[model samples]
Target: MSDHKQNPLSREMKTHAMILGSFVAIFWVTELLDMSIFRGRLDRFGIIPHSLVGLRGILFAPFLHGNLAHLIGNTIPFVVLGWLVMLQETSDFWIVTFLTMIIGGFGVWFFGAPGSVHIGASILIFGYLGFLLLRGYFQRNFASICLSVIVGVLYGGLVFGVLPGRPGISWQGHLFGFLGGVVAAKLITNEKRFYS
Candidate 1:
C-alpha cells in the first residue's frame, strides 16, 4: 500500500545538510537572544538541585543557558556532533538527542554536587560526541574515528567547564551532559564488530 518509489525526498528522509543547517540556525538564534536582556533568567527554569525533588527540570534544563559564551560554546560542538549523528542514522538521531537531554538533565540534578544548579547544552554536545565515537568504532570507519578523536580533543576542556566558582556558570550541567552522552552511546546502539 505504500509507494516508496514516489515518496518525495523531503517527505521521506532528511539530509545531513538539513539537519546541520537547522541546528546552526536555531543555535544562532538562541545565542542571540541569550545575549539580549533575558540573560539573567537563564537558570530560572534550568535543572536545579531542588528540581530533582520536584522532578520538573528534566525537560527544561537542556534548553536553558547561562550566557552568550556558554550558549555559543555548546552550540559549536552540538552542530558538529549533531550533524555527525544526523548524517549517520536518521531514524534515531532526534530521539537520541532528546533522550540525551532528559537523561543528562536529570542526571545532573540528581548527582551533581549539592547546591549546584545546572544549565546549558553540554549534555547534548557530549551525547552527540559519545554516539559518534561509539558508532565510528562499530562502523570501523577510519575517517569517523579520526574525526571523533579530533572532536574529543577539542572538547576535552569541557571537563573543567563542569566545575563551580567560575561566576554565572553551570559546570554541573556539563558533567551531566558528558555522562549522559556516554550512557546513551553505550545503551542506544548495539555494540558490534568493525563493519569495514
Candidate 2:
C-alpha cells in the first residue's frame, strides 16, 4: 500500500489556491448577476468621487465590472499575480489584499473625477503588481529579489497603466492601487525584520 500523506507546503498551496479560486468565482458570479438580473445597475455601487453615499463603493467596487470584457481582462492577471503574492506567505495575500482595498478604494473616492463611477478588479490587480515589483527591494533577500525580477520581466508593461493615457480607464485606481501595494510590502517587510 502506498502512503498518501500531503506535505505542509502542498497543503498551504492548496489552501491558497482555493482562496484565489473563490475570489475569481465571486467576480464572475457578480458580473453575471449584474448583467442578467440587475441589468448592469449594480455598477452604480462603484465609487463616486466626493459623495458620502459613494463611500460604500469602497467595499463593493472590486466585485463590480463594467462589462464581460472588463472582467475577463482582470481575471487572468488577478490569478497569476495573486498566486505570486501568496507564494512567500499565504497570509501576505490577505494583508496585501486588505490594505490595497482600503487604500486603493479611498484614493479613488477622494481623487477620482466627479460624476464618474469606478468599478473593476483592476485596482486589486495593480496592487498585486506593485507589491511583487517592490517586495524584492524592500525585503532585500535573494528569493524575494528573484521573484521580483521574474514578475517585472513578465508584467513590467503594466506599469504604463498607471499613467493617464486611456480615455475610459481609471488611471487613478491603478496609480493608487499600486501605491497601496507598495505600502503593504513595506509594512510587511518591516514587520518581519522587527520580529526576526
Q: TM-score for model 1?
A: 0.69
Q: What's the residue-level lDDT of 63 in candidate 2?
A: 92
Off by over 4 Å in 2: 1-5
Return model 2's CA RMSD, one decimal: 1.8
lDDT of 2 by residue, 1-196 (tens): 3223647777787898899999999999999999999999999999998999999989899999999999999999999999999998999999999999899999999999998999999999999999999999999999999999999999999999999987889999999999999999999999999999
Lowest lDDT 10-residue stretch of candidate 1: 187-196
lDDT of 1 by residue, 59-110 (tens): 6566666666767777767776776666545655676677678777777777
TM-score per candidate: 0.69, 0.96
Kindly give the stretch of ten consecutive residues in candidate 2 with the minimal lDDT sum: 1-10
**Model 1 CA deviation exceeding 4 Å by range:** 1-14, 21-39, 52-54, 113-116, 137-147, 153-168, 191-196
Task: Give per-residue lDDT, candidate 1, residue 151.
Answer: 67
Structure candidate 2, residue pairs in collision: none
